[model samples]
Target: MADSLRRIDSGEASDDYLRGGGTGAVWRPPPAKRGALLQEALVRRPGSCIRRLAQGDRARQMQFSRFLHNGAVTVTEMAETAAARTAVVVAGRDVLAIQDSSELVFGGKEARARGFGPIGRGGNLGGLLLHSVLAVDAVTGALFGLVDVKVHNRRGGKVAARRARSTADKESQRWLDGMFSASRVLHEAARITVVADRESDIYEEFARRPANVHLLTRIAQDRRIEAAVDGSTMLFAFSDRLPEQARFVVTIPAAPGRRERAAELALRYSTVAVRKPKNGAAPDLPNSIVLTLVDVTETSVPEQGEPIHWRLITTHTVDSPAKARMMLDFYRRRWIIEDYFRTLKTAGFDIEAAEIQDPDAMVRLVAAVAVTGVTVLQLVRARDGTTDQLLRDAFDPADQPLLETISATLEGKTQRQKNPHPKGTLAYAAWVIARLGAWDGYYGKPGPKVMRIGLQEFHSIKYGFQLGLRDV
Candidate 1:
């Protein structure tokens, strides 16, 4: 199948090769066969269409199906495929690969399966954890692709759980696994920075990550360490170097959900290089340089006079007090991933609702959803390039009647009057695609929703922009 698609893409085979014929086989070429084939191939079982395309004299399609059905394509093969796709998308870009985990709830009281771990209760359903690595363009926020995904399972024995570890103690190990897998796809880039929350502060994570991959994570309160200068081990403490003039004020915007407003106080500067005690059992652990910024805001002063503080730590060099302040600005971008997850779950890909029974199948399905979301995000970023107008021109083309229909439907007085959300080129494009996918029913009649739209539609709209590049 890949060879035939390659031949077609290379113009080596005539359209006849794709036409219907004899031999009890029917080949119906869709209007957008290239896009369709590529999209389907992205998610289809390995070698499913290889023989049907007749690119290989040996290895028939049936044989390939048998291979996949027999589980001949190992998990390593799937991981490789994901790595390749990620490399293709992120090549030559400055990106921050963000790693996090979420839960997918599965209902019913069936026996827990291996590789399935209980996360938390969700209404009447039970949740299973899914750990994912998402590579995002640092400046543009475009999703490059997924670095890797693992289903967190607790049913597996302790050894198996250790093998598929999810605890902070194991994050660095997982980071190593993802880095190697991504390196296979990305080869060596100039730099690859990894950003995560406080849970990522495992000693091994900082010790083992490739030097080229800079690590930035929040610091947990329970983390114990010592100042590296004197080799003195003690509990981590807040920097006492806060400016004497620093004043804490209750600001509503800075501290949301505070009943009587919240204080936003900034300390002047402080740096602490983390060092573990040599006498400890884990003496191999190396010291990690961390610049700390403690922001104490009074969300609600308890009757006991206790104050709340948000502590942030970073590996970034802070030459001056001003430089340290920028660390907060940099950390704000981490919230972008939260927005992304919300958009992904609410827009169409309700990953938590997936019903795939097997762990492998669930992994594949979640990856597929992430792929689709990334493809759309690419379009959004491309069209909304600095000159926001580019998106309006691209989606509201005057020459294309189909696009015109989409515009007209969106511009209808009823839609304008009834819909409160402001519509723009990006929104219009999303709405059009969603509507075409029968996202919310074009005219109130039931139609395909964003989730129901197959990969073909996503490919057609995306490739239609000439943004897609063929893998050589």
Candidate 2:
């Protein structure tokens, strides 16, 4: 199936079946076949628009247009495909299902006509809200893939109060929904830890966690909890009273107006019984839920910027300092999803810039782009040999020969020109692709953009290789 698609993409075979008449009207194959082809095309070339993806081929571009607009192309099916791929790599491994949300804002006079709700500025702009679950190896922080994605548009209106609506009706439901989706997708994993930000701190989310899954979230609300010393007290106040366990230094990355510096942070953690909110109580839920709260606060004042403070709540055991540090490490994986969003948006794919206009089609395209972004990330991580991953982790077993062929051709007589990583490792493949993208082997590592371009060229070569096999 993939070979046939590759032949068509390489222009070695005619796309007559993809066109209706001599004039080149759009025609599609069976729904399943068409979907498969569309998925292949998107993965072959990651770009902002269908025209560029089609590379000026009228038939291919029209085919993508039809596929996106087709009612059968549902987000659920796309998400399931991504989940299945992730499940393969994450099986028997402790996985971190990091979840986060981002806004895709489209700016233009016709942006409002694109059928999306207002995003930025005074309910006047247009865009869609996206929430995604990125699966990562808990031990190595190596990205696996996206397990779930939910894209929605907010309706323009006078929004009701948060308490007025049931949890089902509120947009915050995405957090809980994303967690369950991750659990269902990664059921074979040894352990599944769902990590997220403060927005995911919900009573029902903690109360309804499955036996195999655990939740780790940055504390958002200062809810009432049963104090270790005595009666109920606010979460923040209770945490403030706990004695500091130890101090650790972490390098704070450079940000706007903040030079990178090592921050000495004091850590405190203890188990507490969190009282459920009285206002939005469900009938079957318990009055309180037990959770370990870990408070991480920077002890020293920095020359610039605010001090670091994080109150984290989790279901994982944090009795000892090592366990507490492990929980903190898990929370750090949230940055992986943030980096993914950056790749999907401004930094790499720039999906918002795509010319796709319809809301439904836009949602489907965003989901596809979300999946494609994983490939770039895998290569970026593999650019350095520390990941200890195999080529099969990112590329198919069949592509090994082509990767080897490309790697051999890229090597020069000099030692520096040769691939430094071991053969058959993902790093070796990355080195070959980086060379294809014009990156000097001796210079800095290949980033996402370099890897993305290299991947595009690799797929193009793969298509030609597939055509050559047909002749042989």
Candidate 3:
């Protein structure tokens, strides 16, 4: 075996990381130079990861599949790369590990996609499930990287039919598992705030917080609340009695199924002592836990539009209006992971469409592509450039020249064409990318479609530039 293929510790760094480092973790060293080649092949052709392999000669394509199914390149090691990238990004920053689960449905009807558990209380398709813990800067609201990912097949046959299973044995336990894994990995961050959707409103999870770890989650259960000034109350009842703290505006980004809208929302929050489950399902739960509840209700919107109503629970001290708004923003950042999942599916990487049939190989394939998906989404969201992050943070040195060329071509003539955002800012790279994606370069701001298209085009340009350089 080559020196590069040495089986170092699980948490080692990759060799080709000088390019501002994507999610390139040194999952155990490969048996040969295969590790480096695998990363490069994925980086070069991510949108159609499996297709890229097929496009090659027959012998080589088999090599690709063989590599994916290799004994050494397990999903656990691939996740190590995501963890490594995340640790670097959130080293000293106050960040949120936005946690969520997404399922990939491979075949249409009952194909029984290998190695996948039952999803959605028993649904149509079969495929693997992933729960991701992605780290994002809380202050700038920028996505740093994925801190951790847990991939498993659901077991919902007669196994799920067994009614005696504890909640710990259920799938929802993935939420708690994701939180603990993320917290343990990102404990060094200045602040590790776990943000989740309403599904994570687990009382036991709230009670299990580690030091310096906080949670800002939407309240799923309208559980019981301790007494107010006069009498006992339930969750929403406690929320209804609170005085309005303030009102604010938030930008709701567009998704595949939803349109973008700005919402003027009303805010009301109060502290509550949450009583334990009276039924006593959870024996380990505390008798009562005190937490701040923040309600952000839509003040006004067109009747045809969906109204915004968010009942959030947080460990943060929400005494002042400013603090309350801060927590809401943290909760909203949860969308970052949602966008990553979008990239993993049809919106971008399209990993589910891979032609591989082997279950283990598909899992390994999805793991690598998951990191690539994050890289693409990161470029799309790295607009603020508040951190003045270098273009090198995302673009390679060789690729920068091509990016500058496109940037110059896009910024034709007038001041509008000239992106005023300084170099090294994400906005600067984003402007160039949006233009490459075929934006008019005059639109106010590019939407996800434009960013997604532009990223694909930019990857092509990078590939071409590399080929040209190699030909020299």
Name the best candidate (by lDDT). Answer: 2
Q: Among all windows of ten consecutive residues in candidate 2, which has the lowest summed lDDT?
A: 17-26
Quote the lDDT for 246 in model 3: 99
The sequence of per-residue lDDT tens digits that candidate 1 reaches over residues 431-471 is 45445454443343211224235223543554454344453
Residue 411 error, candidate 2, Å: 2.5
Highest TM-score model number: 2
Error at 171, model 3, angstroms: 1.4
What are the runs in model 1 whose C-alpha is more than 4 Å off? 1-70, 73-93, 111-115, 121-127, 158-172, 179-191, 221-236, 244-268, 277-283, 287-308, 340-347, 376-405, 408-472
Tens digit of lDDT per residue, candidate 2, span 209-285? Answer: 98889999999999999865677789999899899998899887665588989889899999999998988767688
Predictions in order: lDDT: 0.45, 0.78, 0.71
Candidate 1 has an lDDT of 0.45
Give the runs in model 3 whose Cα sits over 4 Å from its true position.
1-32, 113-115, 160-164, 228-232, 254-259, 279-281, 384-387, 397-402, 447-472
* lDDT: worst 10-residue window of model 1: 18-27
Cα RMSD of predicted structure 2: 6.2
List ranges where model 2 is wrong by over 4 Å: 1-32, 228-230, 255-259
User: How do the residues 1-472 of candidate 3 rate in per-residue lDDT, one tens digit apiece?
Assistant: 1333332223234443211224322222232444455555555455545556445657556656666777666666656655766676567889898999898877744447464555554466678888888878888767767777777766555564423555587777888877887787787788889999988998888888777789889998888877845556799877876788898788877655678778898999888888776662477778888999999999877334578888999888888899999988888888878878887787776777777777677777777677656666766776545644556555554455676777887787888778778865566887887787677866566645567678767767776776898999
Query: How would you order the candidates by lDDT, starting with the best?
Result: 2, 3, 1
How many residue pairs clash in each candidate at the backbone level?
Answer: 6, 0, 2
Task: Please list all clashing residue pairs in model 1, or write none if there are none.
Answer: 1-50, 115-153, 249-263, 250-262, 251-262, 438-448
- lDDT, candidate 1, at 252: 34
